[model samples]
Target: MASSMLAPAVGDIAKEFRASDKAALAGQTSFVCMLGIGPLFLAPMSETFGRRKVFVVNSAMFTLLQIPTALSPNIASFIAFRALSGFFGSVGVANGGGSIFDMFDVHERAPVLGFYLTAPLVAPSIGPLLGSVIVRSLDWRWIFWCMCMLAAFVTTFIYFFLYETNPVAILQARKSELQKKHPDVEYEVEGASDESIPKKIMNASDLTCSPENGTRAVKILTTQPIVLILSSYQALIFASMYSLFATYTDIWSQPPYNFTTIQTGLAFLGPVVGFVTMSTLVILYIDSIYNYVARKNDDDGLPEYRLVFANIGAVLLPISLFMFGWTVEMGLAWPVPLVATVLFGASQVSIFNPVQTYYIDAYAKHAASALAAGAFLRSMIGGVVPLFVGQMCVFPSTSTRRF
Candidate 1:
């Protein structure tokens, strides 16, 4: 919504721009659809090209494409660039969880997953906050330029540090290094030989080829309960969050409290404070609890223990929602509702981290695939929720019906 909020403004820049609505919707659809489809091809390529090269190159390419979107000439150009941005960028997002597993053990995944989970929620919010300030202070073009620069920075960082964590590739590199040191060394480091390519191809074909793809997708859909239940709950939670964003202005803008778009946007600061507070609390406590649980269980490090945090979030969420609902419904002071909104953010992040991490843990080997599917479902809600945000307050159905 942040990326595309100015899309309407972008449409207005040219009176001949007939494609803004369709273009923006198409752009989001393309993003969500491409993410679902990319894995079929990109995952297979991971074997041939190797992980480090794929991520490092694609990350840079994805980042670079934002430049064209920044410089787009019209509606068609805008959608086209946005779609390409999502396409090239999908590679890192699609494969990143797998990289985390390669780099960290189950026990050590807490911090890394926290960072990943934080980035999407926090970055989008932060991106828009900065983007809005820039748009107000400068031009919308700065948003894309800023994105391009950030991407370039990350691309440079990745080139310096990202390496082949694939066991086969690393071992081969080690073998080659040893060979350089010992000219006559005949020691064979067990390795996958190029001669076996055909057999590996056959296995790969059976596993992921088009003929098996449909059944595998269905099988995964049916088997992964975490993918279904947790993702659906996440979608609902997001829908509710956005509904609040939409309806908040209605309550705030009435009776000597009417606010400008900028003020309404700034109203989001309360929710941000809530999210940061909850995120900090959860991140800090989860580690201590993980250690405590590890010691209590004699160091087996079970993932189910994360649910204790999930319960805390569940309680906080409903409590915050009710507080927000009635506070606005009863026409309590504006601070009452705003404080409740902050509480909602706090409750959300508190519950958000551990549940997602638990899902990854339960589906460890297939964590990327699960997270991808869940991410798609969640993104859909984030995209669609705003459409209803505009309608929530005016409906006589329920003054607080939005939540």
Candidate 2:
């Protein structure tokens, strides 16, 4: 939610800091890039140290980092601190699905994941809506200040409520307790002998230095055909959303439909509605579709069955893109572009849920690494594409092509 605020406030940030749109946008882009990149490191760290520990530590850091971003006097400092905040906050993005799988059975995951998946995707759209109001009423710095307060609240909540959900971590703790109770009887960890606390710590350090996990991530990216294709496909979808977020503020504030900051933020309601409606419907029906498909295949479910909704999204996505482009380019009725946003957001819900679930099912043991690779690809594209969106959206014939 906080991350998405910058899209609506980029103009105000640029005006105050005496920076170009692209430079102010760099503050957002750098955060996104680090948000994507941080997961690769933290995902592996969670495997070594445990998810609860890593999550709490990173959440604390995320809250602290937001302070500098809110207090930054210049664009450079804001961008740098924003990037650092993203790096720490991304722990949730990367590990969230893994934690979900740890808690729920496969059959129960569809509806639960539907809710989980929609929150982050819908948040970017929702953030701009509130940001427009905040920016209108206050200086741009207040935007970051609001986010800081929210993050601090969340960090405190997580510290108290969140538990270590990783089965391996839980089992290890149990074994340690049993070992203390019965020191003479040998209790063995699978695949390796039990070591003392200090020795285990050293082994974790050794594993961190090992090249195996790095090689595995690279191999997954390069060698796995499904992972590669889906990662690329999702990257484009994520990039399109970011493009809209980045461009909408500038476009709405200009000529044929000049709008105030608050009004521009209100425009995001269309996408928010679309995302909510689509996600709700999917949660209601996704499991039924899986059940129907499973019965047809002699009571066995396949990961491929999830792709049914994804194909529906495939059809709608391109059509919506065309609708959005034509409506905005021709300066049609205000509702036309807003309706197009609805379509685009609906399409994203259809596509993202299945692709994410399929990855977890297909690579259950290695799901973390697989997801990290996908996150990296999608975020890199999302981060980099916005830099060129302003240039690409311009038409030579249109006067005042400010976006």
Which runs in model 1 stand beyond 4 Å of their true positions?
1-50, 175-219, 241-256, 291-299, 322-334, 385-403
- Candidate 2's C-alpha runs over 4 A off are 191-215, 395-403
Least accurate 10 contiguous residues by lDDT in model 1: 209-218
lDDT digits (tens) for residues 1-403 of candidate 1: 2333342233233444565443444544454445445544444344443578768877788788878877777767866776667656667645676667667887788777766666545543444346446666777667678778888888898899888775655776677799899979864645444436565445433454242231233245456785677767777776677556445545565643456546655666777787777777776778778778888889667777776677776877888899977766666666877788787877777667787777667766555555555555655665566664554455333344334
107-192 per-residue lDDT for model 2 (tens digits): 88888888988987888888888788787788678887788888889889889999987777777778879989999876665533
| Lowest-sum lDDT 10-residue window in model 2 | 206-215
Report the C-alpha displacement of residue 280, candidate 1, in angstroms: 2.1
In TM-score terms, candidate 1 sits at 0.76
lDDT of each: 0.62, 0.80
- Error (Å) of candidate 1 at residue 378 is 2.0
